[model samples]
Target: MIPMRMPWRQGDVLDLASIGSRVDSLTDLSTIDGGPGARLTAVRTQAQAFRREFIETGTPDSVTTCDLVTLPYPTRFGLFRASRAIAPFLAITNRLLVIRWHESDGTPRVLLFEPSDVELGRYTPYFDKLAGRTPDVVSKRMVTEHATVLTHLARLRIDPSEVDYLMFDHLHTQDLRRWIGTTAPQPDLGEQPTPVFPRAKVIVQRDELAAMADLHPLQRPWYQPGTYRDVPPEAFLPIDGSVVLGPGVAVVKTPGHVFGNQSLVLNTATGVWVSSENVIAAECLTPEHSRMPGLARWAREWGQEVVLNANTIETTVDQYNSIVLEKTLADRSQRDSRFLQFFPSSELTASWTNPGTSPTFTHGAIAHH
Candidate 1:
């Protein structure tokens, strides 16, 4: 049953025919096809075609978004121009997106996006420093409650071994050694951590790999390269460009937040949805409705579709264009038609403590059959 359910094989060639969705799912999608301009044009064209065929038509078995943890993040990072609304941080929840879809043959499959192992994640220097810098009014726990990806799997009745893929929007603050196991024993887990999702092939963008290998000074604090290095190479299934995983799902390259940033696009019972950390709040996409001070006005002034989560300015133009691509490829929210269905994988939530800094709109959880 397990082998029969797997849609991908270890050594199977990922040619267009084998990839199943008829979309370009290559490992070197970001190798600058003709140059950066050509690559952007090419990705945009593919995204529109992908949306028309996959996202606009089909439904996944279901896309259940479960809360893994909640923590505070910088306000400036959440919105491009937060103005005088709040100081320091706002509450954000990182969700584990459980995507269950099927191959054309009707074999069942599951993909876990952002199964963040919190313990390993703290190794990020910037995130680690946040613990000490947060005001005394903030709780030291970093999150109100915390749980592992496995705990959520149990609650959802998803067996760990059955998961087909494990992925993140980008590698920011992610430490995967625990999920896929490391090549050598280390102090972090006292030994090489045993694999949590044993059969899962981790999906990563090839460009993200390059970004990690040659980090710019600005990118260093956000990534813990040390934690990623020891993970066995076989554990990863790196793709270069946009590729549809199964019905209603494709990993689209949306670089800017990081050189290798990608967004998960899923077609659900309601409409098309794009998930990533490209923008932290729903208002960032639909700035017209934003109640947050200055956010809406800034977008109107600049004619921007979405205000970026500008933590790293490395590829600002590409990131902005990527957000537009995501917005273009998504359906308007079924809950609130005014907003696009761009779910921030780590969504910023409304909190009274962070006055004048709440999101204009919040789709608490995605609605799916």
Candidate 2:
């Protein structure tokens, strides 16, 4: 028989105080210190620097290509509360990106951002509680067609082992050990290190890895324990600052949704596309507009500078700064254009079709700028 799982208790792993101390010990890349005040200061100083560097670096001369694939996943209507008034009840997709570019030396590189291949059954408990619906209700809402990451890759005729790099915006409900493997057997999975992408390297912020070990009690629900315990140190490409992956692709330390959260920025023919889960939709960035909803609208009414995703409030000020930095980066990329075209990762799915209609899968290449 399968072993029964024990309920998580306060001391089952680590205490709240210890978690906070661990987070404090993690390296923070921003100029400002760890409090809300420093985060607010970072909103102006660090965000400006982030924007300036990307603009000054200029787009790579080599042809850069990108495409968005909407992977099927379980999502609640309430998650997109801002747009609930418009559509009421609807399903959404987990937007994933496939990026291809060449280095200065002309070596071909392939990167996958949030290659989510989650099993809904594994997360049924969280979905049931989050949507305040029964198991039956949740099951009916989940879209199963074209769900797995392998199927999408198969359609593209690309092999997972050929991938050069893999990244996630944060560690929320992710199990990278399955893909990258570990040095020893994982507690939950009694399996040795068996990497799915044999040659690929996983890139993550060092601060994020630290935060995962000792998460805030409130933030614990979104992470899986022992997920990274077995991952060999050499397999990880942990960064403390912005890292240029290729000529036109860079992973910038945004740090808002989580203490170690980061965003992927790519210079595309359309414009700079930022792959991030920090905000649910593009509307979150334009809080000044009246049509903006939820925390964004509230922020505008309260005369706040920016709005955030409202997932983790451990660092509210830092989240605000991260959002501002995203906006600045998008703005600088479009200085010559008449309007903005910053693509929120989710927008790729939500904007694909009208609400209540079946999803129409689409794909395209992001030509060189």
Strongest candidate by lDDT? 1
Candidate 2 lDDT tens digits, 1-369: 222221122232223221111112112545455776666555556555655555544464433223323323332222333332344333434555777666655776778787654652245334436545546554444433444666667876779878888888876766777677777786566568588888787677777766665666767666764455557666666666566666557787777678878887776655566657666545456544424224345655577744455545667666777776677666522432422344545442443223532222212223453
Which regions of candidate 1 deviate over 4 angstroms? Answer: 1-46, 134-137
Candidate 2: misplaced stretches above 4 Å?
1-52, 55-92, 120-125, 128-133, 142-145, 184-193, 290-299, 332-339, 347-369
Write down the lDDT of every candidate, Cα atoms only: 0.77, 0.56
Where does the lowest 10-residue lDDT sum fall in candidate 2?
18-27
Model 2 quality (TM-score): 0.72
Q: Taking the candidates one at a time, how many backbone clashes does each contain?
A: 6, 0
Name the lDDT of candidate 2. 0.56
> Model 2, residue 345: what's the lDDT?
50
RMSD for each model, in Å, please?
A: 6.0, 7.9
